[model samples]
Target: MFRLAAVVAAVTVMATAVVAQTDVVAERKSVMRESGKYFYGALPRMLRGEAPYDQATVDAAFTAFADSAKKIPGLYPESSKNAPRTSDYSASPKIWENKADFEAKVAAYGKSIEAARPKATSLDGLKEAHALVRAGCDSCHDSYRVRH
Candidate 1:
């Protein structure tokens, strides 16, 4: 009876941990998808003159980028390091392996967003600042996002 109880307790604990990890992974994915609207959506087209220049869209893009930068570092808890990968996107194990470096990269990304936020007032201004912002994203993604 004692052994059965222990087994049940162990299973419960394992299930709880799995739930926590799954929650964090889902939250991170949702955040990424929200911000991707700007990166992969309207912002790029506006920058390239493929879409009309709307101040609101530019402002929203930078705002989302800045907000996501702040939220992103916190989203990658140790519990999430082992989450199953998806063919589309998943946190790279490299993020946990070099946690400090990954966080520093996130900090740099935040700085880039701040630097670009002011410049995003106009299409031309946004164009000028876009490269630095993109570089920040590339630096992290190239090393810390798994797309397989």
Candidate 2:
């Protein structure tokens, strides 16, 4: 009776752990998707001269970009072999397959946006900043993420 009880308890614990891990992966993927939407949607508006490039707007967008970049590393850690299950996650296994290159690209994107933050003042300046930031995102997406 004691051995049977222990086995059941262990199985339950393992089941719970698997569910928890699945939830974590789902949550991370959600974050990535939301961030991508904001980058792709809001950025073009600012770049095309449709919207004014005030400090407040530029600051807000850049903050979002920076925050999103910071989260990328944490979302796909080394231990998980499976790709995160979420909509449009074209983040190829190659991202983790060549871990060093992935990390370097992510880091470079962060640095480019950080450098652009101060230079963005007027519309032209903001356009330049947008281009720099978008270039980073474009490079990463072209290499790792698949387009829908």
Clashing pairs in 2: none
Global fold similarity of model 1 (TM-score): 0.91
Mind giving the per-residue lDDT tens digits that candidate 1 earns over 50-129? 99989887777787888889899889999888887643988888888899999999999999888888887777887877
Q: Judged by lDDT, which candidate is best?
A: 1
**How well does candidate 1 score on lDDT at residue 53?**
89
- lDDT of model 1, residue 2: 100
lDDT of 2 by residue, 1-148 (tens): 9999999999999888777667667766776656566566665676776665557766777777888788888876654456445565545767778888888998999999998888788777777887788788888878877655
Q: Model 1 off-target regions past 4 Å?
A: none
Give the C-alpha lDDT of model 2: 0.75
Give each model's whole-structure lDDT.
Answer: 0.85, 0.75
Per-candidate TM-score against the hidden true structure: 0.91, 0.78
RMSD of each: 1.5, 2.6
lDDT of 1: 0.85
